[model samples]
Target: MSRIGGQLASRGCPHQVKGTTMTTQRETGTAAPHRVLILGAGYAGMAAVIQLAARTKGCEDMQVTLVNPQERFTERLRLHISATGQQVAEMNIPELLEGTDARFVRGWVTAVDADAKIVRIDDNRVLHYDTLVYGLGSVADTVTVPGVEEHAYTLNTAQDAEVLAERLARLDRGTVVVGGSGLTGVESAAEIAERYPGLNVVLLGRQEPGAAMSPKPKAYLQAALTRLGVQVRSGIEVVKVLPDSVELAGGESVAADVVLWTSGTRVSPLAAAAGLTVDEHGRIVTDATLRSVSHPDVYAVGDAAAIRQGFGVMHGTCQGGMPTGVHAAVSIVRALDGGQPKPFRFGYYHTPVSLGRHDAVVQFTHPDDSPRRVYLTGRVAARYKETVTASPWPTYGRMKKMPASGRYQRETYVGPWLPEPILTVGDTADDITNAESVSTAMLVVLETLSPLERAVFVLKEVFDFSHAEIAQAVERSETAVRQAAHRAREHVRARRPRFTADRSRQRDVTERFLAAATGGDINTLMELLSPDVTLWTDGGGKVRQALRPVVGAQTVAAWFAAIGKVTYQGVEPADMNAELVEINGGPGMVFSGLERIIATVTFDFDADGRITTIHNIANPDKLQAIAGGITRDVGTI
Candidate 1:
């Protein structure tokens, strides 16, 4: 086991794996595998799948099966982008599950059996689950209004988005009506207006756009909509959807060539049918642990589960949904290990709304999602929004191996510990965001500061916190907090590294260096590397690698040169797909041989873009995850 894995074992991490006697197929006189059947491959369901699969990797007794309607992962967060004719990355579910024993079944779920624990898929297929995860996420509530089910378009799926995309593409000049003034509606309206400048876009809803946000962010969002040529009509109800327009409750009709509905959500009725205790809205009513109150065997997640907190029942969101999934997976593992499950707790942090590809407004929030005074607007906020909106899919990729360790601050309770921070891959000036407005290089440098100083700087500078709020988090006086923030700012300003070399130039150098190293060209490697460059390899106890850092350009270059001359395990250099990729917001490369993924290399550069640090990851388990992790973004539920 690796050091991290060892820590997991010692700390009693729920994912301790052990082999079992059961096989994959029907065996004579053999016991059946412990089947974990997960329904709906959304953000929550996908999280459960990866957590359960990785935890149960190589265990013969445990079988994790994920059932989704489609094989391709849905980017629910960016359906607006998809609807605008943008091409998002194609993430295949089965390809992601490769090498793991987890099975991906493509079929629509028709029914569920609470007593017998059998799930009927497509009315023709049946699956018996030792444990069932109910995550049939919600769709837009289209049945409430007249003619909406037939007349309105929704960004509920990629297919739905594509339908809208084709419709919009066909319309040369017409008005687009976005029903609802929620974040989704606002975003959709802004995107449509921005994409098709000729099309008149109108946002109609019961409340103002960004109604939930504080006054500042709310105003910014409204202004942004106006800037994008989106007409705002608030406090108006849509009584009916017509063929080419919508009729309002006030007997007013708005001409629209296309109508996109992003109103209230309605979850699947499978849980209610199966005798699970459900809320009035058809969401499964869950206890503190996320298990169904009526059916203890069924754990519900995502929008399907009406999970209650001190504040209220949780709404369907990617942020809260993912944690519930991870918690459920951990709880299930604990249950299997003869331990009681812990209660699930989550807190909302930020609401990022994109006002098109170029601009956005991000509203910071309290645990209850009521907006805080702070918010981000314009291009920087847009980038931050993009990072978060795109982060989930890749975060799922990382979770396939290492269950991200949750670190708690010594300070009192704040926001919930999440899966992982969304760190973008590939370096550039564009990479710096999160209203931290700090560059990756500066962020990296900030990590070296004392915890209090770091917190103060981030809260004051990045989050626009008042001195009083800073004092509360750090348990210090306002004056002390301000002084600490000042000291931290001075420290960072003195040592902040600046990069003038553009990404393209750096990418060229990195790619060429990778080419030279793969081809065993020692001279090229030496020329590219800094004189005092160091090579760090993290084998993670699964493979043999240098335990100590190898320093000096000549020594590091010569070592790689010798290794490249002779391929290991009957694999030639030609078999290695030495492809350039982005890793942790910097350019990186992956070496995949025929038999397995040989290694992954992440680099750090000096201001001039010369190679400084190379993080060559060759861990057996991690290498496999990296193969599929490089691609994909966006998710559902």
Candidate 2:
């Protein structure tokens, strides 16, 4: 018997219908494990392998196998350094797979039969898989321009880099032309010019280097390139590449002894050849969960997949690629557990570009990949780039040690803290005492306070606790408690307004606001909203949401207008039901679809009855408390 078969025999090998792995055992009377074949073993592929192996460590019913052309892990982020003959740390795939449920196979994948769910290795070895992860990654486009494939060198792989390094080492004096002025081209040109001072280095591309960055960082990058004795020629196209030179748009030939092409990328044709749906770029078109739209059993990640987001289809980068792999693994596990996978949402954070060994530039960005004003340059940026480039291996190691539940446990009573709602009798006389303490506006101010200050303030002001008692309750010194209490009191007094809309007027405005937002009427929404309106979406960092407060009437109106046009949580726009209800002793809105509360939107108003602040809580964990609609008599706390 095989090793897994022997183990299954000792355990009686009972059939299970809840898991995808035991499907083979159910169909046949024999024990067979579900095989997962991962292709490429790049940064993204390795993340999937490690996460899946660690998550299913002791499961004899599931088997994972990784196939790649080499046993060494290629650090694509450091490829430019390696291309310059610099040393980088070597990581072995099989060694990393040791002590896990996954095994590594060193071979090139010749073909993939998606219909048969089988893979053909270069040596004619066939492997059957219940699931396949396509992360073969992309290589520099050698087929685009003439003579590029036959004459130019590329940093596509370690071996390719070594070959280029050997050629550069032999040349003592010659012009080295680096094609494409993207980050790769800039880094290559800078590295060559720094390493071979006697050789002339020229960077040629259509767009200037760091053109996407803000003005300051872009200027810094350009100045650094100039200081390195490198010539940069932008706004020109390379029509053809020759062995001795490259032909520009105007029939200008740039003399070169060595040409490193870093222009464009091309994905493997295996996905399209296997009959999987591919986009214009020949990358697998995946659903929101990173699964192939045609074949849900196949998950695609990294440069091999074209994934769409709210902003747009994601570009290939390690920052976004690794998350795709991790999300694929999580989704696969959820499917095996007889549950549907949630949608995947990602936003770009920063872009780090290396100029050379000792210089670099980092541009901070918003979630939509737009450049932020903040940036770093010089050695500080270089160190930052090196740190992030070297982080993937260690991150994988940490993922292996973390429990699956621990990695995704946002529901365990942990999130941005909020005060509990207070229930009041519905039709009673409006004679409640100290009502500001329980008002929605006051709660908004409390949210701005530090956790400790908020706790102390609530205990002392609302509950009538003395300094000693408040200190005991919050586990703080009396002096500290007094200070926090003073600060909180002063902040709330300065910020909180003594005005609120009655329930009837509030409900009218809420109904209008909901209608305008759901109807995509940006003009009406802007009219109803305050000029300085701020929208706060609390997703608990568990779902796609704004990383910062969305401010301004125009921006907030546009955001909601877009939300009105799309389906959410499998609920169609026509099927969604938005109802106005009383929440936290104030009028609010509850969005329901598919018989569950999809989200809750509460508001805080100013004296003029205009909506000043909007709070949208969409975290599933928080929504569970009100899954069943509000009480007919009153809204429960």
Candidate 3:
């Protein structure tokens, strides 16, 4: 057990303090614990310590120490909410680390001596370590714009946020200028506008808020800001921040009583000062293993590390940051165990932004962080955003019990995953979608549409309902329904082509592809698939199927060919019975094992009769649609 107090004393110090150290243990011929010193207690730092501590709990040969400015874990994601006089939960970091083999030191990191392997705390105390996890994190840059450091406030810490909250509460009516139209600026402006209804909240930045999101969600975010009375001034720069106003690039001045600076990013210069290589932004430059390029003993993570991936240098984000911490912990463990650490790879998944308390927008992204066509808005998005924000604490708790839970297989899973698959099977041509019934592939595309848009599209396009009828059925304004219909149509038309294979041709193609896949004939499978064919598998995270969409004929063919040789879900290849059948007015295949439907595969083809897309649905809950038996006479194409 560790006997160190809030301030750690090291025997490595030339003066030889009263406390114990690894150097003393070595001199006495006793084995010393492998020490891992983690700096900061932010999202990244906490994740690294928790994962490492949990994994090393029963082992006495390892010790972990975490140093931070405060014991309370700051919810950086909700700092904007806190800045509006709203109360956030007080999460004690020590309490979370109580049962683990981890010690928490509450003090600001003053300096790091890389050569000595010692860290200097604000109180002049020193802590020594064998491996150092440099996750000091970053803060909002207040030194960039003139007078910003002296005049403008920033939400860099919990105290900083509370200071703004106190100031906002004291003001009866005034203008609050939020510099930087990024996500932080947008959330701040919205929160201030909602809480202080009398206050004129002006969001000033060069780019419009939600510019990184797609058009639909972007519009939704902008509309929510407008509803909250946030004055958005975009495409304009804040050259200088004054005591009572900000100077724009065009020499225009905007008056403000409270200036909240949420613009730019800056990391601590401790790494550079300690003789470690740093990037241009003062972030420690890390190799693929997340270890410092110059000093292999030091590992940098979070916003403080300039780690590069195939895409580019990773930007600061909680989504990406948490993973880096977990990866670093895993790497550290591997290295300590005499194994080489693997390279780190990550892909951005989604961007959830909150607008006030009830409204939000969630923009789905590709592995490369590019915006996908899917998004969510309004209260649903707000709930999703809230769930994501509150997940870290519980996630850490779960990690304490299950260390492997922190690991994410992002390299294999590179696409957006739906929580559940949509069942479009019906008994007749009079189904809601159309006379022919929408294929599961097309319905998958429609799943990307908003609830209102999907409703409008189905009513107007399938049932031939007029705009007035759709508006009344959906209880929406006619104009709004019209706009939704237009968007839905454009989205669908752009994704799904008007041409399709004939029923006989589709059946033949499905038969050929099934025979090739189940027979493990990769060459035949490739020949049967389009060069750009995409395979989307939905296991709902329950089954061990692919969570990502496998693209390219070669990759998909190889994947299916391998599946044919292995026993999956307790079913042997010899016991699996797959047959081509009519499903959703198209040719589909169902694989049954042990007299039960194990999975279903649907095919989508181009006009040339080449299989262009495949939807593999293995979700047990969604299999209810075809569990009993799919009627062959559902419809005639």
Best by TM-score: 1
TM-score, one value per model: 0.67, 0.64, 0.65
Off by over 4 Å in 2: 1-31, 403-414, 417-637
lDDT per residue for candidate 2 within 1-637, as digits (tens), equals: 0211122112112224355347566467665777788998888898899878866777777788999999999998988889888988899888888878798888999999999999999958998998899999999999989999998999989988999999999998989999999988998999888888899999999999989998878888898899999999999899998989999988988999999999999998999999999999999999988999999889999999999988888999998888888888877766776678888877787899888888888887877899976565665567668889999998887566542321333223333433432222353334323344466667778889976677668767755778886654334578988999999999998877544536566667888888898889999889878899988776666656665788988998898786568988778888787766666656677777665556778777777778887777776545533442223233222
Backbone-clash count (model 2): 0
Compute the lDDT of residue 109 as modeled in candidate 2. Answer: 94
lDDT of 3 by residue, 120-201 (tens): 9994899999899999999999877899999999998889999999999999988999999999899889888988999999
Better of 1 and 3 by lDDT: 3
| lDDT score, candidate 2, position 326 | 85
Candidate ranking (TM-score, best to worst): 1, 3, 2
Report, for every candidate in turn, its global Cα lDDT versus the true structure. Answer: 0.76, 0.78, 0.80
lDDT of 3 at 496: 71
Model 2 worst lDDT run, 10 consecutive residues: 1-10
Stretch of 10 with least lDDT, candidate 3: 3-12
lDDT score of residue 604 within candidate 1: 60
Candidate 3 Cα misplacement greater than 4 A, ranges: 1-30, 413-637
